[model samples]
Each structure stands twice: as C-alpha cells, then as structure tokens.
Target: MKIKLGLLYGGKSAEHEVSLLTARAVSQAINFDKYEVYPIFITKVGEWIKGNPLMGPVDTVESLKISKETIRPNSITSFLPIDGDDASHLDVIFPLLHGPNGEDGTVQGLLEVMNLPYVGNGVLASAAGMDKVVMKQLFNEAGLAQVPYVHFIRNEWKNSQTALLQKMEGNLKWPLFVKPANLGSSVGITKVANREELLTAVEVAFKYDRKIIVEQGIVARELEMSVLGNDEPRCSIAGEVLPTKDFYDYEAKYEDGTTNYAIPAEVSPELLEKMKDAAIRAFKVLDCSGLVRADFFVTDDEEVIINEVNTLPGFTPISMYPKLWMESGLAYSDLIEELIALAMERFEEKQ
Candidate 1:
C-alpha cells in the first residue's frame, strides 16, 4: 500500500515565501506510485491549513496569499492525532519549513507530543540548530571550528546602549555581522563596518527576535554539503555559492537570482574531504536524523569553519540541497524515497 505522507510547509517565519517554494518542489518530486502526498500549508499568521490550493509555483508572494486556506490551531482540520484507530492514516510528516516557528523545534515538539512520525531532527536538535548562538556554543563545546560570536538580549540593548557597546567592542572586533538569533534566510541580518552601524544593526535585529547575535565576519568562500540518513550519515559532494553581493544577503539569495553555485566546488581534494568529514561530525553531534544541509566557510589558510546546519534546507528545483545530492548520483525521486524510509525507520525505533 502507498504510504500516506503529510507534507507540512509554510509558517510564521521570515522565510515563509521560501517555504512555499520548498513545499511545491517537494510535492512535485515525490513519486506518486510509492506514496500519497498531502500538502499542509501554514500561513504567515500561524494558521495551519490543508488543501490543493496551498501548493503553488510560488514565483511571488501575492500568489501564496490568494491560494492558501487558513486553519485554526488545534482544529481537527489542522492537527491529526496519532492514536486514532487508523494506523495508516498518516504514515509520516515531511516538514519543508524554514526559520523560527517552523524549523526551530516548535513544530517538532508538537509532532513528538502527538506521537506522529516526522522527517528530520527531533526537538532538541531542531531547537539547537535554529538558534545561531546556541548552535555555535554546542559546536565550540564539541571542538568544532566556528566564527567567534557574542549574544545579547533585546532588553539589554534597549535599556543600556553604553554597557552593551562596551561589551561588544571588548569581546569582538569591527566588520561584525549582527543577526536575529532565531531567524534565517539572511533576514534581519546586517554587516556593520564600525561602531555607528553596530547600534543601528542591533536595533534592527532586535525588532525581529528577543535575542540577537553578533559574529566576527569571515572573508572566505562559502561551501555547503548535503547529508542524508541517521547515525552514520553520508555527505554529498561539496558545492560553492557565488553570491552576487558583498555577502549572501536576502536579495542575493532569492530576489536578484544572480547567485550561482558550483557543484564539486573548486577546492583541493584534501580540503574537500576535510569539509565532508566536518559536516558529518556536526550532523551526528547534533543528533540529527533524516537529512541536513551543512554549510561551511573555507579560509585562505585552508581552515574549515562550520557556518550552520539547516535541518530543513530549501527544496526548490534549484535548491542547493537537492542539487548537491543529484550531483552526488541520487535522483530527486530517489532522495525523496530515502528520506521517507529514514523517517519510518526513526519512527519504528522510537516506538
């Protein structure tokens, strides 16, 4: 029998539009002969809706607003209980969400409580991977190479600019990146050149999240590797992203579409091997399952520093995650099948 797969996407995240793109790509890639796909879309207002209208080509934001159905929280149409008599009701849930409420363990926690099988990492790993500050701390504790960073609460910056500036200057240097700790897709991120820009950047970042993180910006090549499976995960050939700006900002990533990626990135074989090794280590360290896209930065000196891991990386036809795997010899349909098998395996293990 074909498995009933609930594909969850879109959420109250800065990356909501990107999530829609991912959902559309995933829904199209899955083999219909092996599984039945259910598209569950969440709106920007945090409404979990169901229906065929939610799935879209998603070339623009205006299209999603018109196509999506709004679902109320805890409504029978919104959430499904795992204890129902029909065990075949929903074989698994594949979350193609990005940023805060979607990829940051909030949705994973709900799945765990509901006893539902879902793809990707569990609560702890999802939460750890979402918070830049916390993820960096865990990486540091694991002896992983990463850029130095400092975190600040919103109130600290709001109430006392004098002390906050003093602490940041003392701990970090100029050319720092101020970011909302819980956001992704390069949203609410600013690369400050000096002290004056730092204050404004902090204020802007705080508007998006309660906590903010400032990291010493690294001038290095951006590399990414896609990992698959659990326990002993496998890494794909490394890929390099050539951003169309000073950095991979929001505009460069999605809007301009000028960004180009080189699969099997032009790097020394030794350096490539090291990056793959580091990527797998970081994935296992975080107890991640299913699939994760690990990003890294290779310095001029050949040192590899992990950037961050995306538990639910983008899934658009042009997305790097699927592209990397395709270059590594896995077809899009095969990749989807593997993820489903892994999710079912993880569920069985937990049961």
Candidate 2:
C-alpha cells in the first residue's frame, strides 16, 4: 500500500517563503507510486491551509499569492491514517519548514501531542539545533570545535545596552556576527565591524527574536555537508558556498541568485574525511533523525569549526543539502524515498 504522506510547509517564521520553495521542490520529486502526497501549507499568520497552489514554483512570486478559491484560509483540517481505520490516516509528516516556529521544535511538539510521525529530529533536538547559543553549548560539551560567542535575552539587552556591549566586547572582538538565536537562512543577521554598527545590529536582531547571539566572526571558507539516516548516519560529499555578499546574508541566500555553490568542493581527501566525520558527529550529538545539513567554517589554519546543523534543510533544487546528496550518488527522487522510509522507521521504533 502507498504511504499517505502529509508534506507540511510554510509557517509563522521569517523563512516562510523559503519553506514554500522547499515544499515545491519536494512535492515535485516525491515518487507518486510509492506515496500519496498531501500538501499542507501553513500561512505566515499561523493558519493551516489545504490546497494545490501551495506546491508551485518558487521563481514566480505570483504562485505564492494566496487565493480564496485555492485554499481554505484560517481553517483547521484533519489527516487520516493510510489504513487501519477511517480516523487514522496519514502515515507520516514531512516538514519542509525552515526557521523559528517551524524548525525550532514547536511544530515537533505539536506533532508529538497529536501522535503523528514526522520527519527530522524530535522536540529536544529541534530546539537545541535551532538556538545558536544552546547548540554551541551542546557542541562544546561534545568536544566539538565551534566559534566563541555570547548570548543575551531581550530583557537584558533592553535593560542596559552599555552593559551588554561591555560584556560582548570583553568576550568577542570586532567583526562580530549578530544574529537572532532562533532564526535561520541568515535572517536578522548582521556583521558588525566595530562599535559603530554593533548597537544597530543588536536592535535589528531583537526585532526578530527574544534571544540574540553575538559570535566572533571567522574569516574562513563556508562549507556544508549533508547527513542522512539515523543512528549510523552517512555524510554526503562536501559542498562549498560562494556568497555574493561579504557574508551569506538574507539577500545572498534567497533573494540574490548570484551566489554560486561548488558541489563536491575541491578539498584534499584528508580535509574532506575530517569534515564528513565532524558532520556525522554533530548529527549524532543532536540525536537527529532522517536527514540534516551540517554547516562548517574552514579557517585559514585549515581547522574545521562547526557552525550549525540544519535539521530541516532547504529542499529547493538549488539547495545545497539535496545537491550534496546528489553528488554523493543519491538522486533527488531516491533521497525523498529514503527520507520517507527513515521517517517510517523512526515512527515504528517510537511505537
């Protein structure tokens, strides 16, 4: 019997548009013969909408323009199990969401309460992976190499910017990256060269999230590797990103199509092996299941520093996660199948 898969995408997050794009890609690649797909789109206003228009192309912004006829806006819908009983339907949920509310364990928690099986990590893993501060702590505890940084709550920043600035300056120097702790796809991120830009950067970051992270900027090459499966996870061939801007900012990641990626990045076999090992280690440390894309920074000294791990990585055709897997000998269709199977396996294990 074909599995009934609910492809969940879009959400109350800054990366909502990106999530839509990812859903579109996954919808196109999934094998129809093996699984029946249900497109579940979550609007930016936190409403779940059911429709076909949600799984369209990302190039045309018009496809994303919600129409009254295409979707039942502000309505709650239900999914049934593939078999067994009429009330029990959907076999599993495949979340294609990116940042914050979608990828930060909130959705996972909802799924847990609903007794639904979903792809990727659970609540604890998702929450830890989404928060830069928390992820860094976990990485440190795991003996992983990561950049030094500091974090503060919104109340702390609001109480005394001077004190916060002093604390940041003492721990990290200029050219620091100020980012919202719970955001991804480089949203609300600013690279402050000095004190002149630091204050503005903090203000901009606080607008997106209550927790903010300030990390010491590392002048290094940006690289990413994909990890698939659970327990004994496998790593994909390394890929390098050449951002159009000074850093991979919001525009460089999504808006600006000028940024380029080098699949199977030209690095020595030794370095590649090291990075792949680190990626697997990072994935296992977070208790991630299904798939994940571990991002790293290769410094001038050739030291690999774990930047972050994306539990629900981007799925656009141009996304590095899928591209890396393709380069590692897995086609787009096969990758989707593998993820679905992994999700089912994880569900059965939990039961």
TM-score of each: 0.91, 0.90
Q: TM-score: which candidate is best?
A: 1
Query: Which 10 successive residues of model 2 have the least lDDT summed?
Result: 68-77
For 54-107, candidate 2 gives per-residue lDDT tens digits of 333245434544433233332223543433454336778888888877788988
The lDDT values for all models are 0.82, 0.81
Which portions of model 2 show Cα errors greater than 4 Å? 51-77, 80-88
Per-model root-mean-square deviation over C-alphas: 3.0, 3.2
Number of backbone collisions per candidate: 0, 6
lDDT of 1 by residue, 178-289 (tens): 9999877899999999998988898899888899999989999999999999877999999999986888999898899889889879888899889988888889788899
Error of 1 at 5 (Å): 0.7
Give the lDDT of residue 57 in candidate 1: 34
